[model samples]
Target: MKTLQQSRAIIATAILGVIVSTYALYVEMAAESKPGYKALCDISEYASCSRVLTSEYSKGFGIIPKESALEVPNCIYGTLFYCFMIFLATFDHIGVNRLQLLLSLVSCASSVYLAYLLAFVLHDICLVCISTYFINGLLLWLVYNKNKQLVEKKK
Candidate 1:
């Protein structure tokens, strides 16, 4: 695929990522952290995003801490990750492609793990979280398709 088309798709996907992450962040802040604050995404007791988002797993410093060991909100990290993807897509460099690939892998793995956590560990599902996972899967597909086309063109 041409760089222009791929970049456009990436930009769109990143925008979607931002929207989803922001919604989750809002839920985390307004509903999860606060009592008696019902969030829009909180469909039911079994599908309570507030509950899952407020859990201990919702915050961490990731695999490696660059400067400090301060535990950060997962939604905050996700929002930043999506915004970084927007920056990467806008630049349209080889380095951006590599970074997107790395990001996609982590997104996919984490989504899978979260899904498993919901099914087995948590015993409840978050609709907002599932939507983000679906978005991540879409991003993975878009990146794979774009990279495959590039490889095909090179060969």
Candidate 2:
């Protein structure tokens, strides 16, 4: 894709990621505050977003200790990541593209770990979580394509 087209695609994907992440954050907070709160994404007992969001794995990617200061919700990380992606996409420089590609790769790796937890460990299907995973994968593809285009242009 052309640089302009690639940038637009990345921006659009990041916007979707932001929206989904924001909703996940809202669900996380609302469920924490209100007792018996059920999110719209909470479809069923086995496929409950509330259950997944409220789980131990939802914060700090389930890697950081809960007592640690850096143990924030994953949605917060998701929000910041998409925002950073948007910022990086706004700059069309090769270095900026490289950074974007690297970030996307990292995000995808995180998604893989989270997905494993969701399926085997958590044993629940969270729509919101799945959506973010899909978004992350899409962003990785878009950023990778953009980087490949950039490299080919230099040939």
Candidate 3:
């Protein structure tokens, strides 16, 4: 059984993830409107918000443009995922274990992919992006730690 404090911590981390992700998405959308703000866009080389956003790489796997909807970046999907995690953490009355495991795997995978973007693809760190990564990493860690307890109990 998880302690109250541990449960609260997980919930807090999940909420943090949602907030950061949402903020990143907001910044990405806001950048599309102003040309001057394009300089802060994610991605390496061109580094221009407008350039990367307009670039083919910004598109989904292939044909889909990242900012096709509401002119918001695809990265917003990450934020949405975090928000789902927050929902699971705060009011998980069904399959709590399964939810935790799913969140742990997704958060871990997200952290790894985002790190790659920061270190290799982006080559530069935006404050909002960095904060999102930090929150994701923290949530992953907490989930992993909590999972360990479950494993121990089963042993």
Task: Name the best candidate (by lDDT).
Answer: 2
Q: Residue 142: error of model 1 in Å?
A: 0.8
Worst 10 residues of 2 by lDDT: 90-99
Model 2's C-alpha root-mean-square deviation from the true structure amounts to 0.9
Candidate 3 segments whose C-alpha is farther than 4 A from its true place:
38-72, 91-95, 151-155
Q: Whose TM-score is greatest here?
A: 2
The alpha-carbon lDDT assigned to residue 67 of candidate 1 equals 49
Q: Write the per-residue lDDT of candidate 3 for residues 16-116, one digit (tens) a residue.
A: 76776565555555666765564444555434344433433333422465456544454566666666766666643435656766767776675666557
lDDT of model number 3: 0.59
Off by over 4 Å in 2: none
Query: What is the lDDT for 16 in model 3?
Result: 76
Error of 2 at 86 (Å): 0.3
Per-candidate TM-scores read 0.86, 0.97, 0.67
Order of candidate numbers by lDDT, starting with the best: 2, 1, 3
- Residue pairs clashing in model 3 are 38-49
Model 1 sits at a Cα RMSD from the real structure of: 2.9
